[model samples]
Target chain A: MDRFRLPAGVRDILPDECARFDAVQARLRERFVAAGFRFVRPAGLEYFDTFAGADSPVAPSAMFKMTDRDGNLIVLRPDMTLACARIAASKLGAESAKLCYFSDVYDFSAAGNSDREIAQAGVEVFGEAGAEADAAVIGFAVDCLEAAGLSAFIVDIGHVGFYKGILEESGLSPAAAEEVRACINAKDAVGTELALRKNGASQRAQRALLALPSLFGDAQVLSEAEKLTDSPAALASLLHLKQVYALLSKAGKEKRVSFDLGTVKSLAYYSGAVFTGLAEGVGAPVLSGGRYDGLCARFGKDLPAAGFAIGMQRVLRALERDKEVRQ
Target chain B: MIRVALAKGRLASSCADLFIRCGIRADILKEETRKLVLETSDGAFKFFFVKPSDVPTYVEYGIADIGVVGKDTLLEAGADLYELLDLGFERCKLCVAGFAGVRPDPARPLRVATKYVHTARRLYASRGEDAEIIKLNGSIELAPLTGLSDVIFDIVQSGGTLRANGLSVLEEVFDISARLIANKVSLKTKAAQILPLLAKMRGELAAKDEV
Candidate 1:
């Protein structure tokens, strides 16, 4: 193999890009430290069993796995949140902790404009549960994005419970629910409708499920969704979002927040609110996080948590795109 | 301005007609032009005429905020973007077509040919069928006739081509139609612009369905 050629999905940061990368990381570090979050660097490699299992946030296929010296399976750190949760639950020995890191995570399956080795700057708040905590994390996301110098962006929020609530009414099996979730996530009404019908979902649930794809945009979305279902869990999810939205508004971060009940991620991973940061020129999310009240429990402790990670490379790309638009 | 990547030819014309009905200044789409990029007179929209398959790539990268492409193209490309609406035109059926009464041998794998290689492989695999898929750029029907494959998998608009070639649809896999897709981020950041246009399109589609 040519020594000059590197493997696909990995790249060297040139001088210009490295300079910008440093600047963004510096800004995010300052913000995190000022906010009382302690810095932590997780091991670059860890036992594969740590992230292996159905409830793991990182998909098994997404991890770079290898055999360790002791013949145990190990993997590159594939997700920052999981790493932080491990640290907080097992090591912190406290009820609450705020931890931050500017680190790179690995994704074996990353391809076609997505990096395999992703540089992420993120913070995780443990032992905090409820809407206020959610809003605070989201507000900080907006603040950090601004601090990183993104001129135009919005934090789109959602709850897994909304979709899960409707699914409770649908009575579909877990596999079928996952299929429908993928369809809704892609906003494919046609696919969603066909799947619901084929699964013999009840008419009421079908109606609510069909509307899931189009249920997005401002605070009005919360009310619009409220009329669709009577499921208490779903309604409670909306109420939680309303509370978070109100808190964000109180902090003058309302304009930076939007709602999308259809942004349904892995229900097994995120317990409540989920969000992604959207910038003017980027197609994919630059920032992503959610409330995972259930993650720490899997690591031998019980703790409620919320946090987010900004893809430093994507943020840099967004800044470059913003400049191009301005020019 | 809202940037749109439109698949050239019939789908583009149909989308332009739909846009016109929705109060968009899409009359320029009817004009024959050597120009690659077309802008609306009001400067509210910009259009890029691209190949059907490339529409998803353009939108997925956010080079185009939204795109109008056929479901077949979308299934094949599988680009990560939001499927917003069903444009309900350029309708067709994706099917497995082959000579009547001809079946794959029990001993060997079934051979299929089509441009939609990914969609074909997925269809057969999901059914737990072992099949050799041969990808053809065009003239998919010729594959079965030339003994290149046992069957052809492709979009059937009226079954005219398949019938003319002494073939019939063995299995209907997916219903194909033009769909409206948007960049995920664009759907949020440009909601003010995209949502209103989507509302107009939805209204027009509803009216059409009513009639």
Candidate 2:
């Protein structure tokens, strides 16, 4: 019966949509290349353990798994940009590298959930660290979104350490900490308070935890958040975000930028300045990226770096909607 | 223009009252003849009446620049829209309820009936309990009584329904009140109009607090 309709969440990106997808991909590639990022392509499949570290949010069940020739567990690459960084460090020995790619990632959960395969076109800069690199990546993301005709959007900025540092300092058990992280990520304030209370955290910690969701706004959120965190690392992260904001202000994209201490990255690999571009008419983020200093280390290279990825599917969705409205 | 999607129920009526307090006419809301879209006289705003669950989707997709929906809708949809203000209306609580004393046990895979599968899954997962989720469209409270589920995940405003049915809330999951959510794009593109409207609403809310 029509080949079972390609499963519920998986479908063919028809010629019409693919044409627009390719045009967007080409525009991003040209812009990234002109900005001096070398193009790189990673295998669409990798060993499961390669993404099992602290930086990956890929659940094992979410991956399309298979047995390798050597009987090792392998899975289709759920995200090419991260795998690209892994390859750049291990295969190319490029600790400090700038790479751009256009590829489809296979996520099994996409079937019956969102869609299994996603066409993602974006850039990754490895080895460049600090506020300068963060600004550059965010600036590039802004350029890509604007280029795709998403003129009305905001780039929300946050640092992974901002929340992680506080959670670590809460003296929670590993399991409890993970639960708390999930709660905070979901913007479930009541759940967070209950989790913290059940974990027997101090009253001060519980109060601070409950306030996490409301601690998001413009740049002032940084200073307000700094007062809540006792961890030095968390404070340093706040300072780093301030420096990045200054850089964006100099670049004149500061108005388009907002601060969110509660903004959590979808991927576990983001280490600093995690951000997502939001626009009207799209159900998800148009673009997302952050600094992943430890990701390169996973591929046998130690380097500080930051980068961002444009969600081709979501961008196309916004563009198509805009076109429909205009017509 | 700022677009607000109001749930077509008690929350919508309450929101209309708040809008009137904030200097919005809100008379268009009274002409309820299945008209989906309504525009204010000043032509600076538009409102869409939609199902509470669909309000988040509309706001998240930027179809309506903003939305006035209960926190329950936000939790269920899990849309990435920016929740800007707590309108403090339609207040309720999401809870787990079952036959009086048949509490949640983590060891066994409990079956839960709910209209909010995402929220239920997350609630159980957060508690380190894995429960088989059964998604139902309506009358969730009837599931446990009918033996279709071990427990029911639903919103409780006063716990009257549960108590009347010989059930009690085993655990309260979340405190939900109505909130103002903005589409990430509309918040920026229409900032000149949207921000002022938001400021007015905030001013009115603050005044209410003062009174």
Candidate 3:
């Protein structure tokens, strides 16, 4: 009998699939380079601490791990863009760096599901923290999505400070605050209410927490959220989003933009304006990115930066479906 | 045209009432027939009466442009759909209930019975507790009393059922209400129709609160 086949979750991206993937990556890469983003590549595996210290969506178990000869823990990179950012900040010396990357990230969760190794093609613009940089990155993302043949989608924007400000004001214990944050992030209104109530939060705080999910939509959500809280951090975040939206609007990308005040990107990092691109055919986000002004500090470098990653697998799925529809 | 998946029970009735209050006719929904599909006179919309748990799947897969479902089902199914609005009706709470003083140690693995296996699993995992989940399709509150499991994860609208069964809520997992969900695709393609309807519903909900 032939040797047991590859795991169920992981699938081989045969020649045809590879062709489509490369087509999408090439278009994105060309656009990034034209926009002044230099190409950078990093190893598929790195010391485990490299990820442990950074804010990433990948869980530890999702990473392929091993012990080196020197008894050091190593992990097959579950994400490339962030690791590359770390490398650029530390190795390349982060004095305004723009890096574009295309690499296969080994994720164990994908191993028995579908496509164990994902070819992620994305760009990271480092050493810029202004609203203009935010707009440039988002504009590049919109161009990339369209280039990859995703026309009908929305770039839902939010800020990390909005959620953090509410939690800080609630005055819950550290543990309770974490629970509330997780619930809010999950959009679990009921869980959030129960957690806040159990933690002895005031009725005003509870109402504010419950309103979070609804506080997202169009440009008007920012103004409405600003009225609900007195925190300057939240106000600044909303203003930053307004500026970014204004810039995108000026750049003629307003129709594709929307705002989501409840949008939370990693539990840590993401100091401002987090966003995800969603199209009709795919269930998961096709692109996810936000500002992480503190990420460089993890690698012993202080640089304010922001970038976004296109989920090549998800984007490919949407493109394939779009193509089928068109055909 | 817009398609709305309505949960086929009390929640649906309440949602239909809200739509009627918002000036949309809903006589077919009130007729109490076993019809699965209904269309408006203008043929601009359609409604599919689906099982509550299946509503999210319908919306997520784009079979339905939108859905009216309880938060309880949304949490249990964990489907990826955009929750566009909270209807604020059909309120309830998910709780871990068992015979009084039957608390199992956090370290010791306990057996949980529920129709919501995923939600139960997540609840236990979040609390750093381990439990073997026994999934039952109905009468979950009877599980512990029947000695089938150590606890029953069920939605509680009131404490009466638990109290009558000599059970008490050990830990409240989540609070739930009805929500309006939209398929990601529908939000973009049918925004002209869907957005206005969403705005109208929001307005009606606000007006109701003021009264």
**Could you say which candidate leads in TM-score?**
1
Mark the regions of model 2 whose C-alpha exceeds 4 Å error after superposition: A53-55, A111-114, A172-180, A183-220, A223-230, A321-327, B73-75, B78-86, B92-153, B156-176, B182-211
lDDT per residue, candidate 1, A168-197, as tens digits?
A: 988898888888999999999999999988
- Candidate 2 lDDT by residue in tens digits, A15-128: 988798888877777788889988777887788887665546677778888999999988888876568777777877654678888777887765211457777777888778
List residue ranges in candidate 1 displaced over 4 A.
none
* Model 3 residue A292 lDDT score: 80
Q: Which interface RMSD values do the candidates have, in the order shown? A: 0.9, 4.4, 4.6
lDDT of 3 by residue, A1-327 (tens): 458676555667789888988888888878888888887778877988777743454677778899999999999888765586678778986488888888778877652113667767778777888899888888877888898889667887888888777767777887887777666665556567778888987665667777886676688888888777776777787788889999999999988878777666565757887888887666567888888887777777878888888888888888877877689
Q: Cα lDDT of all candidates, in order?
A: 0.93, 0.79, 0.79
What DockQ do you compute for every candidate structure?
0.83, 0.28, 0.23
Question: Which candidate, 1 or 2, has the higher lDDT?
Answer: 1
Candidate 1 structure lDDT: 0.93
Task: Show model 3 residue runs off by greater than 4 Å.
Answer: A1-4, A53-58, A109-116, A186-194, A201-210, A320-327, B6-14, B23-51, B60-65, B80-111, B121-132, B139-146, B155-177, B183-195, B202-211
In angstroms, give how far residue A302 of model 2 lies from its true place: 0.9
Ten residues in a row with the worst lDDT in model 3 chain B? B183-192
Model 3 C-alpha lDDT per residue in residues B1-211, reported as the tens digit of each score: 7888998888878988898876677766788787799987777778998888899988877779899998878888777667777788988888888987766666767989998898888878988877899999998888888888988888998889888888899888777789988876567556678877888998998898899
RMSD to true structure for each model, in Å: 1.1, 4.0, 4.2
Clashing pairs in 2: A55-A268, A55-A269, A110-A115
lDDT of 3 at B65: 87
Comparing only chain A of model 2 with the true chain A, what is the TM-score? 0.93
